[model samples]
Target: MTSPVAGAVAAPASRRPAVALLGAYAVSLVGSRLSMVALPLFVLLTTGSATRTGLVAMAETAPYALSTALAGPVTDRVGTRRVSIASDVASALVVGAIPLLHATGHLTFTALLVLCALAGTCRGPGDGAKYVMIPTVARAAGMPVERGIAFADGTSRAASVLGPLGAAALVGLVGAAGALTADAASFLVAAVVVAVGVPAAVAAIGPAELDADDPDAAGSYRARLASGARFVRRDGLLRSIVGMVSVTNLLDAAYGGVLLAVWATRQGGGAPLVGVVAATMSAGAVIGALTAAAVGHRLPRRATFGWGFFLVGAPRFVVLALDVPLPVVLVVLFVGGLGAGTLNPILGAVEVERIPEHLRARVLSLMGSLAFALIPFGGLVGGLLSDHLGVRTALLVCGAVYLVATTLPALRPEWRELDAGRRRAAEVPAPGSAPAPAGAR
Candidate 1:
């Protein structure tokens, strides 16, 4: 007999619900994008210590890695939709406290760090839950998986532009504290949208344990998490993707969190300049995302994904190392953002294509956790390096590190497995289906 979750996944997909999901995602991202700029800026401005800024960044992201494990079980139990809404609500409360404490003069440096970490912990599962819902959303909307993921990625990039611009304007008018308050409000609003707007059939799937029809779905939380990890380990392409992303994310976090802010401050740009720099990159990302969403299906996944990494990774560091004028740096960031934008859509498509439906949440949680594991250390190290080695030397070294990391996937034999696996995936029928023809595409 078909399980209810299976029935839900098998429902006729529609564009309206998909649009609603995207809308919710976009709203949540607006807040996320604002915090990305405001929180780090807050630490840098208030503390005037690169190390302290790094500590704040570290505090926020460290829980993200650990919280993924916790998120998987909860998502599998409560359903992705409910989990997402609840997480957002919790995030709203946590993030809103920052401004409240600041106004009351009770917000200490340590308190800020703790609150940031609390928010990160809330975000990890919320993000994972939303990710898990994508496949179901695609199925319900009758949308192609690649198209759905591309839209998701594109929406995020677009928000990156708006969020920074809005945050910058808010900072000018009311300070970073005020921008953070706006961030909190965004989360609450996003929760309401997701809860009310998303279709019930697409929103919740109950506990995975009840889905006897799903081979990969049964098991205790630990076993389920381990199963996902094992699949990643055994799959060459997945393993390579996870490994490369882990290193690249670590390096990128440093640049995005500490390096960029410090560079702007030293260059005499201040907080608004920091927002401008971020917005420029995000604008490029929007273009890249739209292009990918339109034509990504025709592109060779390996070449486009790998080369995109090089453009995004190498240029930012090199330009910073050169100490070029701000305009020149902005141009490089724009180009790099274009390349960066193509990456997640490809990765999202590949992930959804490879993992079993039942294992989406668990595998995604593991993947996110593993990918972000080094991020905290990256920010901490970047800050210390900037302090000890100076920003120029740090950029050169980190840029070189990024160059090495991005280049590896192109040459690695395992990376080729991505295409090979795609072909194999195309040949196999989806769950509960008869086998495909011998040479199905």
Candidate 2:
């Protein structure tokens, strides 16, 4: 989960904050991705049913919407570091218990569902907090925002690359149960890293008196959350992204949460094949992230964004729908993942560019929570479709929807506002910030 910073030159002391924050974020992300493989694998291996896997996926994602909504203002109040550390501690214990309970012969479907929900609940805020801290970490490190964001995106891709492969190997060595154990340990280690690595000054929240310049600083938590929602509603680009991501995320959930597992189960290759497929996508993403890190600033926003979505979204389902050989599917996924890789860095750079630091957590949480609102339904529906219409039919339906959704932005004139907003934002200095150094490039 730790990575040497690529494409940025900064003093050692100056870089520590970004390093600590990004490394900690990557660690938790890696653990989350590991569970992405392990939890579904465990349920499928144990219950031998896609329905059960879907239910577990529902349990895992359902609380995230609620927790992230509530966690936003609290994260602003209590500080990202404390929230992250406490959440990871709780998550580690909860995930660790799944294996222990199974060993004790006391793990039931009900208990497992509850534990998965708890883990998701704990992570929701931590994820928000980590994101909110990104600008702070980057500024403290004296790195250009674009390159810093690219590094962050790349690290996440790196983690995604490692998580599935690591989970697959762990599952092979000691079993799916053991893989869950490793996931738990990763969370604990992430907590420790956050606690020890990030400086108190950088990680802690300052007094409300320090927010005299931030207009939304004095509001009630509800008002603050509402302000964030209002900002996104008013901003054409943010609104477009939220709308697009909400549907795409739902489709993605179906693919990751149920479809892949079900497809693997039916194909008779099981978890190992599932890991191999996911790893291919992740590997492509790594390449894409590195490519983005090198030349993202030079890319046109609208065309690149739309085409990236096109490459990543529709093809997987189409490939799967054809019931192609495993090698063919892997090739498709790798190509799709390459397209997927260009997305987040661009999205991250744009969103971070527009949002003020004070409202970052609240707005990010609100936008993210709303975007993910339908994910549980995606899992549930995918399971139902897999069970009822057969997996191939379900794949075609999802792919068709995905194609339509990703294509909307390119044709819509409202998206032209993205370039306008970027120009306006570039003209204004970020609050409490100075001009970037000439050497930042």
For candidate 2, write residues 94-176 as lDDT tens digits.
Answer: 99999999989999999999999998899899888877777667766755455567777778889887787788889999999
Misplaced by over 4 Å in model 2 are: 1-10, 40-56, 97-113, 171-178, 203-210, 257-274, 320-330, 383-396, 428-441
| Cα lDDT, model 1, residue 135 | 66
Local lDDT at 354 for model 1: 80
In order, candidate lDDTs are 0.80, 0.81
Cα lDDT tens digits for candidate 1, 200-314: 6765444544375455555677776777778888887788888889999889889987988888888888888987888888888888888887887678888898778888987
The lowest-lDDT stretch of 10 consecutive residues in candidate 2 is 1-10
List the candidate 1 regions with Cα displacement exceeding 4 Å. Answer: 1-13, 36-58, 97-115, 171-179, 204-210, 213-218, 261-275, 323-328, 383-393, 425-441
Itemize residue pairs with steric clashes in candidate 1: 13-140, 13-141, 13-142, 14-140, 14-141
RMSD of each: 4.4, 5.0
Worst 10 residues of 1 by lDDT: 1-10
lDDT of 1: 0.80
